[model samples]
Target chain A: MQITVLAGGVGGARFVRGLLSHLRTRDDAEQTSVTVVGNTGDDITLVGLRVCPDLDTLLYTLGDGVDEGQGWGRAQESTRVAGELATLGVGPDWFTLGDLDLATHLARSRWLAQGLTLSEVTARLAQRWGLPDRGVRLLPATDTPIETHVVVDDGEGGERAIHFQEWWVRHGASLPARRFTVAGLGEAKAAPHVLDALRTADVVLFPPSNPVVSIGIILGVPGVREALRGTRAPVVGVSPLLGGRPVRGHADACLAPLGVEVSAAGVAGLYADFLDGWLVDDADAGLRYPAGAQVRSMDLLMRDTEGAARLAGAALDLGRELSPVGAGTRGPR
Target chain B: MQITVLAGGVGGARFVRGLLSHLRTRDDAEQTSVTVVGNTGDDITLVGLRVCPDLDTLLYTLGDGVDEGQGWGRAQESTRVAGELATLGVGPDWFTLGDLDLATHLARSRWLAQGLTLSEVTARLAQRWGLPDRGVRLLPATDTPIETHVVVDDGEGGERAIHFQEWWVRHGASLPARRFTVAGLGEAKAAPHVLDALRTADVVLFPPSNPVVSIGIILGVPGVREALRGTRAPVVGVSPLLGGRPVRGHADACLAPLGVEVSAAGVAGLYADFLDGWLVDDADAGLRYPAGAQVRSMDLLMRDTEGAARLAGAALDLGRELSPVGAGTRGPR
Candidate 1:
């Protein structure tokens, strides 16, 4: 099947890993194409270099270079960059830039400085990593600088803007957000591959990413939501919140501030107008889906690649069921 | 009394380490001011980040953060950047940039983007290491960009310009240089402290760095050499080449192609016009000094801090002897 998955951070990476496992074992790799539209919400500029942590994490996880233990950053990473930043007394010490990871930002920064678009830069980076042929085409949400930032009300009745990573990684989404912005997304064009994949997709799956941030930020990019909404493909969303709680991420914390409920029903409602099918955890099978959208239940904990593939397969089955009988069922049908 | 030293890379850092050791223990640091004028010849703008390996080495060595095992770079380093770069297919990977050392480059690169002069940047970076106030200042030779590049004759009979680092660290100086340029030094202004230290010093010392690329590049910076020559201070230098071999570094390899002998005499000739005294190794005690310069012999190994201190003391003594008959030393006058 030709699957197009919209993804966020760690949860998204895990989901995609599972999806890849499912597709790879079905016939041969060439029979299926998985294109990922990755969120750029957690991107940050540190020491004058642009760092897209979410994009990199997805790439590394998919390319077999990710640190399995950390869930973010590269494996066998060193803290040289972080240590140096500490010596300089730069703030936000909790979120670090690894030395090896810094190389990616440096190369990306250099390429962008040379006038390459984010999409082009990402392609070059992926090529270098020998990750180009992974049956997946990774695309940034947009081909421009679009940072997701949160505005939180300071306890004394004032509000402040924080970079999304600072709110997500540093603060762990403990505080309520007044609002959030995918800054500069209004003018950003969906990266070439992103729009192309959506148009050609047989099925579009939403990995269990954050509703208020991750996947939300991608949808905020001007042409993206329209593309998904207009595609002939059946779009299936996997619930990030299972059993009334977030599976792993801070979706509850991020959603509550935006008045989003942390449940399958809440998430389904958020995407009801676009979702053709919904995949909730077995624990949340009691939830209901929109009138015409198909509903399914499965073990949602993607603890490993095997489990991820299994859930991915289940989600795909539901997607096939929801897809038009002529363009659904199997193998890019 | 104030003392000033013009320095370059490995040898220069070792000399300063020794000078600091000697001055702090045997001489009165309170009454003595030591300003080190460092070469920026080896600075390279790699991946759009300006990296000054020599200056960083000195800073880290002095700050007690140097990776003594590798002979350069930082402690607890990793190869994530290089490994990732290789994955990216970036070239010129012969010289590895350790993860920890990358932090220094990132911080420096950010500051350069902020429009700070390298001298000012160095000063600010110095403060972070909790450096002691012993009237010690590490000043750059010039405030402008002075990249030391080598013109090498390609096998095809044409010449190509290579950055000094690539030529030195990457190629291991295996190729012959048609010519070298401290590029753009003609229009560059000598940093304020460089001239001030030279003018106000009772004695000036040259550390045993590469006679051509290191100390030679410093002199090429306009106003710097003139300031040293025009000052009332006694100028003393240590021979990087002891007997017919370099005390350390690839002095012989770099100088041989230029028809410069790799011996104490060749090193003395490079500074004959300005030097008042020259320090050769005890092994080269019989070696003659260049015109108008007095010759002295000492153990210049600088194996450890104490050895460096001993060498520093020897240089100070030579400075005293070269001063007007019976004239006192700068730091221990």
Candidate 2:
């Protein structure tokens, strides 16, 4: 079976890590291949180095090099480069690049500057992390340079736009953004193999990524939404929200501008056109979901790897139930 | 009085630091300002970041942030970024960038990409190092991108060119070179203020930097050599060679391709067209020098800051003695 996952940074990385862990215990582990399409909307050029927050988190988390406490970045990371940059006043003080983490940006930036596509750079980075050996392929949603910007009041009754990172990382998403704008989303084609991964997958998973910026940004890529809606795969997603609140990050703040309710059902509504199975926290089990979507409720708090694996197992079970009659048992389709 | 110095990396930086030390003990210290024109031939883009080895050495050494033992890079540096790059197979393993040192390149590369000239970027970097406060200004020889390429036998009866850094750092200059070709040198104009610094200075000094690749490359810039020849200031130089041997670096190897003798007199001859005074080690005190150039002998081994200061003092004294009667005491020429 080929599983395609759309993911963001921390929460999404953790969910996919759990899914991989869950798959490891299955009889068909060797037969299962996973393709992850990572969101690149959070990408920013910091100090002339390209930094893909979501892709790096996925690489670190799955490679077993992630900081368990922070759920992102490298384990045993040091901030020597960041400290030096601060002393030189080169980059923003709030967004620190760890010494170990900087190597990723440096490699990515170097490769990109050499004219290699982002997908090519990601593949090279993935090799170092042994992703291929684990039957995992990570790719950016789009190769085109795109960045999410947040429009906010400039304190003069006018609006101004700041890179999403400043809004998210620096301001903690508390800057009351009027709206989110992706610079190149409309023109960006899905990266190589991205549409194919979605179109040909047996199961398509949305791993609790931010609906407004993460998965939404991926869907904004040309042909991506159509691929998801047209794929023969059973599309299952875990809700990022529970009891009108997100487990982490400022999901509510992101949804507020769109006037979407900050609830599991509201998030499910965002994917109503293509979603097959929807898993929500037990606290929101009574909420009504979109028609044609199979709603399931569970204890969604991923407190540890084991808890994450359990949640992933439930999502896979839901995907199996939603799969068409002969599709669930069929070989690579 | 204005003093202009033509310099390279380690040796030049140490000499200038020593010169600053020597001047501090003089009553006219507050009245003297130094302008250092650093070689850009050693500059290379590594891992997509511009690395100005010579200029960085000057900054770190003069800023009191240099690794004293290595004579370059930052103090208390860590190679976490380099180590990570190695793990990712990002750059040449032969060259390593310390975490603290990488920050300087990042800032420089960033500023350059943002449309700032190398000289403008250097000024910002100098501000951080408190260069202005010390009445010191460091400028690249030319703002136009130029790199020294070493032509060497390809071990196949053919000749190929490699970056000067690869020759100097990677191969340790062990490879026999046919010649040195500086890309962009012919078409490059001297950096803003560089020609003016030389033309209007009261005195000029050459530190014991490599004659072939350092001061030689700077002189190769258009108008620079002419500026030196026409300048009213007395030009004095410290020989890079003593007893037919360089104190550091592969100066002999660099001079071999040009068919020049690797001796104090030979190095003095390279600057004979404008050189008014020449200082050599006590061992080369008896060597024959070019006509019209004043010769002085000194214990020129700069084993420490004090030793460097003593040697700098000797060079300064030679410049004073050789200066035109009215020129030596003039203010800023």
Candidate 3:
């Protein structure tokens, strides 16, 4: 089976880990392949280094080098560089980057400065983590620069837009966001192999990640949504919300700014144009989704790797059941 | 009094610290201003950051942040970033850059990228360390790229040139250097204020630094040597050698490649055309020097900051004695 996932940072990383674990247990695991199209809206330049938080999170988590406690950044990381940078009065003091993580940014930024695409740089980093050895491939959603910015009240009569990281990390998303703007979205095309991954995949899964910025940013790319709508694969999505609150992060805050109800059905409706199957928490089982999509309820909270694997298994089952050709089509793409 | 000193790394840093201490004890201490022309020949781009080892040493040593025990680098420094970079296979594994030091480089590189000259960057860094408040100014010998490379046997049959840092730090200068070449020397002009500092000085001193690479490279810059020769201020130098061996670093090895005897007289002879006075260790007191230059023997070893100050006081007294118009000829230029 060829499974492709649209992922964000922490939540998507956990889901991808679970999905990889689920595939590992199958007898024909060698025949299974996974491709992850990671969100690039969260990328930022810190101290002249290009930092892709979501991509680094995925690599560190899957490579077993992530700090499990924080659910992001490298294990055994030190903030000496960041502390010194603060002492030097350079960069944003609020965004604390670890020394080991800064090395990744340095390497990636150097390569990018040498004219490599984001997809190429991501592949180089993933290879260092041996992602390919585990039958997994990670690519950015778009190679073009596409940053997510939040328009928030500047605390006076007017409003100003700030980088998504400033809103999420610095402000804790406390300030009311007037709207979210995807900068460069109109010019961004899917990264190399992204369209192909969607078009040729047996199944596509959206993990319990923020619908607006994570998968939504990926869908915002010029050709991504068209690829999903035209692909023969069944697209399945898991709810990022439970009991009208996010399982992790401030997905509710993100949805509220868009005037969308903070519920499973609301998240599902955002993807109703292409979503064939939707998975919500048991608490939200009775919530009505769009007409054509098959709805199911299961344990969606990924508390641990084992829980993630179980959740991933549930999503896979739903995607397989929704496929017109069923489990093993044996068709060569 | 306006004093200008030519400096290198560790030894020069120790000498400058002593000079500052000597000036501090004077009644007109606040009136004494010192300008140091730092060697940039040892600089290398490690991991894309322009690292000036000598300049950093001068800043850290005077700023009380240097590792006193090691005589270079920051105190209580961590190499977490260097370790991570090695793991990523990004930079030279043998050259370990501490996390705190890397911050300086990153800030400098970022500023340089933003179009700041190396001299401007050095001043910015010095101000951060409060050097300006202490009446000390540090400037690079030249703003142009003038790296020293040593031609050595490739260990096969032919010879190849390698960066001075690689030759010094990695090989420990074990390979016999056929000759030393200062790359970009022809194009390197004295950095801003170098000539002004030299020409308008009450006295000029050459601290016991490596003659071949450090002070030699500085003199090689167009107009620097001419300024020293034309300046009315008495030029005095402290020997970096004591019994035919340098107080610190591989000065002897550097001298050997050029057939210059690693002795006090040999070093003083190189500057005979411009030097008005030379200070050698008591052990080499009987040694003969070139004509027209007064020679004195003193305790040149800077065992501590106090010892360094005493030595610096001796150099100042010798410079005053050599001046045609004695000590208090405070004539307006």
All candidates: DockQ:
0.65, 0.86, 0.74
Q: Give the CAPRI rating of model 3.
A: medium
lDDT tens digits, residue span A1-81, model 1: 578999998889989988888887876467787888888867888878889887898888987889998788888877766
For candidate 1, what is the lDDT? 0.80
Candidate 3 stretches with Cα past 4 Å from truth are: A155-158, A330-333, B154-158, B328-333
Candidate 1 to truth, TM: 0.92
Best by TM-score: 2
Greater-DockQ candidate between 1 and 3: 3
Interface root-mean-square deviation for each candidate? 1.6, 0.8, 1.0
Candidate 1 Cα outliers beyond 4 Å, as residue runs: A128-132, A282-289, A327-333, B25-27, B67-70, B133-135, B253-263, B282-290, B298-305, B325-333
Give the Cα RMSD of candidate 2: 1.9
Give the true-contact fraction for every prediction, in order.
Answer: 0.90, 0.94, 0.67
lDDT of 1 by residue, B127-175 (tens): 7754546456888888788898888998897999898888888788888
Q: Which ten residues in a row are the worst by lDDT in model 1 chain B?
A: B324-333
Winning model by lDDT: 2
For model 1, chain A alone compared with the true chain A gives a TM-score of 0.95
**Tens digits of per-residue lDDT for model 3, B42-106:** 89998778899999999999999999998999999998888777777788878989999999999
